[model samples]
Target: MMTDQPALPAPPSAEPADRLLADLIALRAAVLAEAGERLARLAPGGDAGAGIHNLANYLALRGHDLRPLQRRLMSRGLSSLGRLESRVLPTLDAVIEAAAALAGAPSPTAAPDPAAFFAGETRLAAEADRLLGEAPGHRRTRIMVTLPSEAAGDPGLVIDLARRGMDVARINCAHDGSIAWRAMAAHVRTASSLTGRRLTVLMDIAGPKIRTEAVATPDKKARIAAGDAIRFVAEGEPRPTADAPFSAVVSLPDLVTRLAVGDRVRYDDGKLEGVVESLAPGEAVVRVRRAKTGGVKLKSEKGLNLPDTALGLSPLTAKDENDLATVIECADMLGYSFVSRPEDLDLLEDALARRGATESRLGLVAKIERPEAVRNLPALIARASGRRPFGVMIARGDLAAEIGFERLAEMQEEILWICEAAGVPAVWATQVLEDLVKDGVPSRGEMTDAAMAARAECVMLNKGPEVGRAIELIDRLLSRMDGHVFKKTPTLRALASW
Candidate 1:
């Protein structure tokens, strides 16, 4: 061991905070070096600009303990990564120099460079380009339209959408069976071939969706009013006699056991609200708190959400496995629903492997819609990087409900940043231009939302009666916004006077 040398003269401006930052910088460098080595071993062919490996390696080495530091940085409003890197590197180096002088040791000369810091941004644009492909005329962003069941038989509609600048056709497996799915895929393929437009077919697998099961009522529906009590019984449990005016069974029987009293439950995407009043072994009673002006109609197969409960249900279901078999056969990309953890990714990979579908050929799009998914996003992306052509879908509907209505805006921005850091494509999804699609007229707010969605690699539009018009509007809007904005950076494009 070397002997300790005498202390040198203190720097002109040295503070305790400076010393702490310097130590952090030094530790960061060591960790980065180790992470770099691990990345090479893990994904030899991964892009250097793809920062997922870097983040993954760090997480593997240090676990989630350092996540607090990341949160603190975020809380301090370091939203612009470009700005954050520029400030962090220099400050860290200054601390290193001061610490070195005080300890009478040689300072670490090499620090994180600009190339290292901005690799994620560089790779993000590249990956997004690859996934969305180059669109015509003015826009870089692509349009993805969800296909209705009619599109399966309506070749004209498919062709029309393709001509209107729809880069992707999304088939939701939740509504239709395999027969309808095959018909839709065929139409899309034929449309692509004839139109000479490269349109991708994305199939969404419906995961364990908690929904209201068959309700035995005279009108096949029950009107629920505020302050009304209803019992959610499991499949095997007998419905309580005279339990309010109506009762319904939940699709997932296991969920009945998991719910606790006082948990807030939502129906029809929170249009109807209730709180659990009591719980039994396989049933629970909920008191409705909110409803429509006259009371809401409760229908079979409507979505049910328990926001205030810690759910133990896995994201996967037997139906998902059956659906994946069909998805693997036809779809270019698979949209996974309710994915909350990395283990869910593992289950998907295993299923794909068993079906002889390699990660390189098929694309995986993780649907971020749960509070748990939001918290574990970095790890999810890191795990996803192990596979090729992975992307993220910001399922804003369930996400908004899960995290609460108040936090949705900030949460979405955070998701965008994490996706950017991982160098993956993000699909801005759910209720985009809803009024325009449903009512054949655009809302001022929705038009603005569509413009903001232009920042994402792809904008997903749900099926509507006027969906074709919605596609045309989205295409034109994105084309105009493309020249004005590129991701988070604004491009100073000249405004058209026309």
Candidate 2:
């Protein structure tokens, strides 16, 4: 964005961003060197090769620190623009700068209101009481599944996951109502009490799913560049397309007040990211700007995001209100999705407090999928601590979409670091076993991904007909990691260099 300071210098040539990544391997060593000997000793091997192990470990935890690596790469684009004044580009310096800004930037998936964020955390904490906590103190990769409707519910899936090392269960509020959940609650009680194994059920109330009301045609892999304009409905209208596609859509005028020209908006926790290009009396136009991975994308069902600064929408939706009545439950943990402000938590406490679920006994997990959510994490934690001890899930699917597919890895790690510092139990969610569950076979890359997630308290997987098998895959990969402990943390540098 800065003006050219001088005539362009020749770039390294033809290598593209991959070359920048190669340079980062060297930078990783340099950064790890800053850890000094004792911490350095923590590296898998004794030599500089240890940096690779630590870097892999850091990368695996999916923390925020690796952001530098990404920034260092994207800023490479600027270097191609040539010298800034008389200074030669530092290899891929500008790419790194952009990656840094992009990576470190708050997610467009956030709600503009601070109260709403805290409220979401508190409410989830209260709900988390019903969900399970980190068993004592050790973090394990857990399998999450929904139980059948009643005590007679098909629990073979539940038993299978447990036998295969499932640590948690989830009850989606969208499907079957409270009757189903009550059965699930009873079933969980029986299984855990009988096995003496702690089983947590997460109550995921389908909170405010935002989409363009009118149907929009699915794009075969979509692209939304900056400066493009897209249409949105004020309250949403029927469209000729089966689904409506835009950066986002707002039904509430209150939400409309939140926008400005450059503010970014997102949908589906961040499967879509766009900037507001302009606004009308009731509607605003937000152009799509980023999508990390390619997929057949559609906007049939809506999702939430921070489209601008002035939104005053309440975090608790009508659906949330309806879901709360029957599902205000006692669980080992609770997850507040699409949260952005503290007041949202207070409202939650008020809603469930009389049921006496004030978030104190519960394990609250905030799903940090938005930029503002990251910014408000400290307050969210404090509210959770004061209200109840809690945890966080760096919900990565939309998170990567919101932040930038490229920086999702780093942003997640940052969330982990912050949560660990506060002693909050963290769950790494979305796409852990995606390749395996989605494709019925694990890719070498995803295999490594699961092994790395072993560092976190919990790793979540989407439901598949073979969901239990997905859990088994995580166990299998992690088991191999433990078996090969000496080599599991191998420094790629050593093997490759030698």
Best model per lDDT: 1
Candidate 1 per-residue C-alpha lDDT over 54-88 given as tens digits, one digit per residue, 9 for 90 to 100: 45444333532544344433343322323232123
* Candidate 1 stretches greater than 4 Å from native: 1-49, 53-119, 216-222, 236-243, 495-498
Write down the TM-score for model 1: 0.79
Runs off by more than 4 Å, candidate 2: 1-139, 146-153, 193-196, 216-229, 236-257, 267-273, 288-298, 302-304, 307-310, 325-330, 480-498
lDDT of 2 by residue, 297-387 (tens): 5455565456345465566677777676555564556677777776667777776776656545565667887667777775565555545
